[model samples]
Target: MTVDRRGVLLAGTGGAFGLYSWAAGAAAPAPKRLKLRRRHGVRPKNILVVLTDDHRYDAMGFMKAQSFGDTPTLDRLAREGVHFRNAFVTTALCSPSRASIFTGLYAHQHRVVDNNHPIPPGLIYYPEYLRAAGYETALIGKWHMGVETDTPQPGFDRWVSFKGQGDYLPGPNGLNVDGAKVPQRGYITDELTDYALDWIGKRSGKRPWMLHLAHKAVHSEFIPAERHKGRYTNQTFRYPDSMRPKVPGRPMWVENQRNSWHGVGYPYHGTLDVGDYYKRYMETLLAVDEGLARIMDLLARRGELDDTLILYMGDNGFMFGEHGLIDKRAAYEESMRVPMLMRCPSLFGPGEVSQVVANIDVAPTMLAAAGLVAPDGLAGADMLPLARGEEAPWRTELIYEYYWERNFPQTPTVHALREDRYKYVHFHGIWDVDELYDLATDPNENNNLLARPGHEELAERMSAKLFRLLEETGGMQIPLSADAGERNELRDPKGPAQAPFPPRFFRPPGT
Candidate 1:
């Protein structure tokens, strides 16, 4: 293997070198290495991260029949780059998951465990780090980090986001562009993507630029782009067998439940009758797929497709009637597991699938793609080698955490350990009991083996692993006792709150 002074490889052992050389050489000349460098590394010329709200891993076409519809663009990404099969979020809640992705920390370390919680003023976002390291940065779409009134968004030179979850169409609280709330006249997905493309198209910065295009589509109240409204309307939706109404057996924690975003029984407020909920979800996802294709097209058009590092991920997994629940904030695979994909045509081999990765690793991975050193305090490791299909035995197990949702009391604050074949969920609340699954044998997580005599020891061992991970992750603040109900009462006097569902309004159709 040989690497030139320009860091361009002349030859190598693995087929990766040939692939990269062919691709990169076919593109524009190598970006000039700048003198504005750090001890750790130099900045990438361009970075594009695309994030979707509340999307499950199975929803992608690459995931293969995990859901009802196909995501051709996402599938293309997976075929052309790396896909982390075991990618998961630190917290399944939207804001906390997004925060962890940016900070490379767990929700406990970041302390923004819920939607209502504000990002601590001192916490540095990864984009801020990029800016400090001499990269131009921009954040676009769906900044649910805080309420809308808090303006002058942090960490980005350019900012475009909504108050919370903004309407799909134009309304009073439609969209905000750099502190200005503007009435967008088209579909929210297209508008956000257009703004992101505009930034990339018009960028005059000599330094590297990091563009974060976060989408609001595929969230609740599944509204699709107008053209997509009738696309999947005729398709038959397959409901998961787990969605059937049944008693999720007791210690009362599993069986006893309250109103939830995705709950069993009658009169779910947002429930639609004209179409199956899952079908609507698939329809909503169409817009995201289209948006991704557009972004790729823009990159190709600008001649930056090969050099730019492109990342695609979901904030957290959403439940499509899995475990008789909706939304996230549970340790179940359906809620906790998210889709993660990366494409860096210059450095990494393509079409690799990594089995172990977490959303917390995203920041470090981005920094590594830019050849920058991740901050010392981050808990996530740089996963570039893993993404490049390097055969290093990475993590065999991952830790999961979900703080008690102050508004929704049905789901408990839980922590779990997921090894290659086993999963153990320990409920840190009084209402619930522990859960253990041999994922290799029981992939659906139907049978809980915690109380079974044969699996008791395995459960204990997994619990110990979870504890060690908690310590490693600075999750000492997480209470170990099974007195979660009392803890909730003590922590939040006005407890068991429900998130406010933002109202939907209309916008003019796009060209």
Candidate 2:
């Protein structure tokens, strides 16, 4: 049976003439008695997933910033929920990370490797699974998965998204509702929050609901709402110490990337000033804090505070001068790690979990919260047990893969294996160098131990493990080799090799 975009199943209703009926001669079987299992605690009847674009893990006050502005609402959420301290994304790009969260699959499995790549048409999002189990679903704010001309997949009953990254101010490039472009009148962040609250107040279902309140704030072209315009204008912002112009013993790849796309020195139009960029960035973050406050207030007023599972995360982490980089898509810690806070009063006690988890686990966790079975074929496990503080055998190491052929080519085909104490980054391209870090001793990843005599055996073991992980995850396309010619041909240096499509966008300088 087919279902319409509105989620109505297009099958015939039961009628006397319908086939496959019970035999008339069979005596009406006594109503089969089924025993219902007693639920442990109050299961959340609603879920609110608030996601921001390009938000860093350490940007909030709860993460113990030295001088950053206070994010009271987020702070409270962190205090009241189970904060995953080691949360990282499978792919550190916006679209790919979001797709991983939705599909519980890695970038290679989903085939959405970059911003311009379309999400595979047949993949089912967790919201579709939730809707199948009797829940209302709605998607608000940015949906950067693909071009807006394509119809939204059959998950949400309501959709409000744009084609790609949209501007903060209202104009022709405003948000798209369902499929029609709607001119926005106010700042995009505030408008998105307003729609989210309105939808919650007007929903007509007694069954549980899942609201995806995705925001476009804290993204590039960082512009704050008018109310937050001058909040951080006069504040003397403190830059990360790592942003210094020079650091001794830094690798050539990192030193040369000082003014690249991930670099703070890169020219971002004429509007940005190197001396004052952090001030504007802080101001832009205030709007997101305000948005969080608004969402919390709405939930409190509706008496859904204790019954809703609120999950807050960034689509991906961003870099601010770490190793002289400013954007994401790198295998480094700053770019790969994202903040994940889950507030479900019914399930988890108020505490922080330092266990490592990936963005791929988000879908199965959401499915479990809705009391539905996660579909088979997803790579992630149902993380509800972990969220509930039930100790289980978890992954000791995390695998990361980034096919770096986007508009920015500053990095290479980076395949990394990150254990608790060590990190191994294999570069499979001509333009970059391989790296290995003893994370326990060098959290900054400043030192490469690959050539060190004492670490040779350790490096060999980690390299073997990395290859094993790649083989398990179907990441064998990019081989582990240092030959520039072989690597370039394997990666198709001319353009995207897998598909015969033209380059999605031009490769900027220093990319």
Candidate 3:
């Protein structure tokens, strides 16, 4: 497992599906709507994406977190486009990273790995292959992968959302739209951008659309939008490097999460004040950066804003006090790195890419920005030709997972891999001692160089390249979803109201 393969695997696409052409097999099956096979874009462009919930990866303002709390439209979208600077989310919660960004697989091949885990009847939802290729797909807000029904599934033709982790408070559990629940009154990120500009003022723009929005902003009970409540209360938060308490080798399941329940030494049981929880998750990300400047002024007033591709991200990454943990299922690096960006100034220009993208490469880079095709095993990587600088065959090693939830049960069932500046991790049902982290001289992983004595052959060659990338991305099962029985813990807002919520994850004994 020295990580090298010629002709990067295809055919029944389990691994490097970055090689497309339906990864040598499965294709014909998306048309639950538009039915397209011809207009492979020399024209049909449009695609918005956004997605926020628990938005981390240094809560924007261009990776300068602390008092630099502001994201003028995601810092002018990272100074106008492309900042992939190592994005991630192989499964760092929130409906298995939004079902690995709408099914490019892996949450153990889309069994919807936990969080009301349902959708497993032979998955598929890269906007149903862009509404069967003629685009015009639309899934507006937080559709927490079939949990308590927002009811309007199968690949969009306009379907705003709600139910499960929604409610940035447009009047408690409202807006369902395409299936009509509607009630949405005030601020749930400005009424999902005023019902996405009233569905782009009733579009008849003929094809090319993909919307997706998905916000439920800055998760956790951190509701900001009272004009960003007490705005960053005179800042001051920084504290990361495994929030101290003797580091140099910290990993006894991160010292058994200091008394559990997502413990930053007693978090859920109270006391989380990382200076008022990073000032209400950076003031609930300034109304998701003013609803991305009102959807970039509604895509520059529908002139399609320099030929639409836009993106933004984060269905994962969020852990304030770091390994003392705050939220997000931890494989750590602040719970699976996130914040990605992308734009489309007539195809691709801006800067900062760094590679390592994830959340299964946003549904084959939104089915290759609407030109469609990525189907087969779809594990993900059409990062639009690595965000259009071209040259394919990317991914050097990245695999992360997190499965211990019966309501956080003190973090376990892990597996990590990062490669190039190392990372390793591996814990699964915990017996301890296996961590590596030389993120090139401890990039804030606080130096747990695994049994360091000259790093025992780099931790046995990254534990055989983390089980050969968990058998080339199928993640070798164990993602556990044999009807995870008594479910309902969508970060617990009394969804399944088990009355007084105690550990309750059940369903574990051989399912």
lDDT values, one for every candidate: 0.71, 0.70, 0.71
- Tally clashing residue pairs in candidate 2: 6
lDDT of 1 by residue, 1-511 (tens): 4322222223433322122233333433343232323435444748899999888888887666543587999998888888888788878888888888887887776666677655543456777767777788899887787434426565699988777788888877756678776787888988988898788888765778899988987887888888877666677766666665432432244433323333533214344432376677788888888888988898898778878888999999887666656667878888888888888788787766657688888887787766676666676788877876677657788888887755456677788888889998888755345888888887878777754457778888999988988876557565221221122222222322333211212235892
Better of 1 and 2 by lDDT: 1
lDDT of 1 at 179: 78
TM values, all candidates: 0.82, 0.82, 0.34
List the candidate numbers ranked by TM-score, top first. 1, 2, 3
The alpha-carbon deviation from the true structure for residue 27 of candidate 1, after best TM-score superposition, in angstroms, is 51
Please, what are the lDDT tens digits per residue for candidate 2 over residues 5-123? 22111232432112122243323333311122223553536989999988878878877653656688888888898888888897898877888888787776665666665443345
For candidate 3, lDDT tens digit of each residue in 61-156? 767867558887887877878888888888888888888887766776555667865553335567776776666778888888755678898879
Error of 1 at 28 (Å): 47
Candidate 2 ranges beyond 4 A from true positions: 1-44, 147-150, 245-249, 267-275, 478-511
lDDT of 3 at 107: 72
- How many clashes (backbone N, Cα, C below 3 Å) per candidate? 3, 6, 1
Question: Relative to the unseen true structure, what is the Cα RMSD of model 3?
Answer: 20.6
Worst 10 residues of 2 by lDDT: 481-490
Model 1 TM:
0.82
* lDDT ranking, high to low: 3, 1, 2
